[model samples]
Target: MDRQKYTIALLGGTGAEGSGIALRLARAGHRVIIGSRDADKAARACSELAGLAPGAALSHDANPEAAAAAQIVIMTVPHAGQQKTVQEVREQLAGKILVDATVPLVPPKVARVQLPEGGSAVAAVQRLLGDAVRVVSAFQNVSAHHLRDLAHVPDCDVLVCGDDPEARETVVGLAADMGLRAWHAGAIANSAATEALTSLLIAMNMRYKVPGGTGIRITGLEETAEARRT
Candidate 1:
């Protein structure tokens, strides 16, 4: 699980999804930095995570600093705050991989698919960041509830989408390190599909009364030899 360890930062790391991801990354032996608008809140979250996974090499900082320090930065903020958060860290994110887990779920009608004007949220981020930053889309469909429960292996796979093959594969590896099967799901534009699935999954969760939330899985594909290395 510790293969090619990296210093990863979780922007908006004080949130539920961000905390869960931070825990898993720390457990995978990556140097995990929890980032938040409030530096104190970020540190508190790190302390709590350190208690949950002792000696996990966890730390915290304000979002901008976290982005500057890490090789890879993940945005776990809500759709409403996505643009602002990315803009705040834009300078720091240059020449680094920005993993965006943003889902466009307009409140009150969250179960209904509500894509942004540009068709894909990650694509917008990519355009905003330009070519210097490799923006990869992922984790929009993963259940944050199950992610926090380390004992439970999530019964779902991750669909990683990015224009850059190397950056996309890097995220696939990170997902694997977190103990979940991940696949390269074409380019970042395909993120619209994955983002929409979150709403569909939410609808299903309510209809089926699934407590931990529903997730998507890809069937029938065998792992390639290269995938096995990661």
Candidate 2:
């Protein structure tokens, strides 16, 4: 499959996880707009990423403008701000693939599984955006430390979930572009499992004393991995 380059907007892209994601996307030859609540902050992030991904098409904007201008919008906001951010950019999200990477970790107790009322954070995004938006859940378990390191191909897998099969495939391809294995993990509701796994990974990271943060690899998929390499 030929890879398609997209203009991707990472909302709340000023943060560590968001910036790391933007860097990978920009390096993959996709145009990346780092979106933040403050335009200056987003611009600063873009400048920093430019050095990391030299000659990569990278820019910045306030979240709403970024969301409106991009082919795909990725939500990387903190769980506390997820709802407000989505509501602010709701109109711009229509007819676009909205990838929700929001993990509902309630701070200090982040190691404990604390799923929201709907069970899945991305599902809440889907409900908020309605049918006009193709909301896909991904990147919940990818470590920022791994993504920021250009030489490091994350020893992990991305489980993409969405109500739309095509949208899920698009995200799976995007993950491939980041040099990671990804799979269609079924409907949007299935995202609850992946989202909840973030907390478990956190617990394991602490218990095992792994500095780069622990990640997941789906076992017994050698054939799938081989097919991708062919």
TM-score of candidate 1 relative to the true fold: 0.96
Judge candidate 2 at residue 209 and give its lDDT.
100
Which portions of model 2 miss their true places by more than 4 Å? 225-230
What lDDT does the true structure give each of the candidates? 0.91, 0.91
TM-score versus the correct structure, for each prediction: 0.96, 0.97
- Sequence-dependent TM-score of model 2: 0.97
Task: Write the residue-wise lDDT of candidate 2 on 1-230 in tens digits.
Answer: 66999999999899988999899999999999988878788888889999998999999988899999999999888999999999999999989999999999999999999999978888988887789999999999999999899998999899999999999989988988888888889999999999999999999999999999999999887777643562
Candidate 1 weakest ten by summed lDDT: 221-230
| Candidate 1 residue-wise lDDT, 33-121, digit = tens | 99887877888899999998998999998889999999999999999999999999999999999999989899999999999998998
lDDT for 145 in candidate 1 is 93
Q: Could you tell me the lDDT of residue 33 within candidate 2?
A: 90
